[model samples]
Target: MDDLPDDALGDVLRRLPPRWLAASRCVCKAWRRTIDERRLLRPDLLPLSFAGIFIQFDSHAFPEFFARPSPSSANTKLDFLP
Candidate 1:
């Protein structure tokens, strides 16, 4: 599989069931990169973790959001006006 070109590998990965495709990602960095780069996995199908919540109070001009120090939230920014 390592010898296979990225396009070919991605084609093969796309054929696998979601479960198997996920396991294939753990095979190696190349495989993982191929999967991610091609977006072979459906994000909605994967398990989701609770990142945080946004609270808006009537008196407050802006909403307040709380999130764990996670990669997902590292670039999160709230820029809406109340």
Candidate 2:
């Protein structure tokens, strides 16, 4: 794996499942560095963006909102005014 070019390595690493990726990070310093340096976080593999977290104050009501992944440029949390 180390023999591959950085871009090639990133392509391979980005396809790994999250658990395997986490384990791969533990393998060695070189692997860890490669993973961190490339930052191969594909859009489909990422978690939904942290737009905001809402909790309801009412005892009888449950609040719900769907989270969708935001583009890298727009990761801001704004208070939802009722």
TM-score of each: 0.59, 0.43
Quote the positional error of residue 55 for candidate 2 in Å: 28
lDDT of 1 at 6: 93
What would the per-residue lDDT of candidate 2 be over residues 17-76, giving only the tens digit for each residue?
876886787788877788888775444654565766767778799976656666799747
Model 1 off-target regions past 4 Å? 51-82
Cα misplacement distance, residue 59 of candidate 2 (Å): 30
Over 1-82, each residue of candidate 1 has an lDDT whose tens digit, in order, gives: 6678999988988999999998999999999999999999999977788879988887756889999876664645666646
lDDT of each: 0.88, 0.73
Model 1, position 34: C-alpha lDDT score = 95
Candidate 1: Cα lDDT at 36: 97
Best by lDDT: 1
